[model samples]
Target: MKLVIVMLGLCCYSALASAGDNSKGKELFQTNCAACHGEHGEGKHGVAPRLAGDASRWSLKLFERAVLSGVDDNGRKLKLMMPHWQNGSFKGDNGNAPSKEEIAAIHQYLKHPR
Candidate 1:
């Protein structure tokens, strides 16, 4: 019984780690990121960089750090306009920050562009 429970726990964790729903990701992206990144992530000229191709290359860790830390993988600060969602707010957007799992879904969506 203990072994079975352990196996089940491991399976659940693995599933979560690998899971990424593009549909849900689209919704989240539209609500949270579209304003700056553009409707299809093509980006706003000189405001935000295109994320479709660029973001897909980022590792999950790097993506998560950027979302939460407002810093690039190299630890350099992003543009001042980029908001840090780690503290559950994006530049005073009133605490509307996505959880890590949601960000994973967004990552998956970004990786597979239409």
Candidate 2:
């Protein structure tokens, strides 16, 4: 019985960890991503490409990799200015880097821009 309880508890914890919340994503994006990417993801002319429609087409895995590693979907390395938010290890003056779950939430929010 104790073993079953532990297993169930672990499962619940895992589920909570994996779940993504778009509201949180929006907040993170506003603080972290909006500056370069634009508040509405419109992109800054030549500064940064538009991510509103583009990022939504990417798979979650690829999106996570790009955000964490500063790589694009085409395997090209992004500019140095792009910060790597690997596992929430991204250090910057503006805001928190974003955990894996937060990345998921960002992806979800990007799917449908407001």
In model 1, the worst 10-residue window by lDDT is 89-98
lDDT scores of the candidates, listed in order: 0.79, 0.78
Residues 39-77, candidate 1: write the lDDT tens digits.
778789978988888876799999999988888878899
Clashing residue pairs, backbone N/CA/C < 3 A, model 2? none
Number of residue pairs clashing in candidate 1, backbone atoms closer than 3 angstroms, sequence gap of 3 or more or interchain: 0
Question: Cα deviation in Å at residue 114, candidate 1?
Answer: 3.8
Off by over 4 Å in 1: 1-21, 89-97
TM-scores of the candidates in the order shown: 0.72, 0.71
User: Lowest summed-lDDT stretch of 10 residues in model 2?
Assistant: 87-96
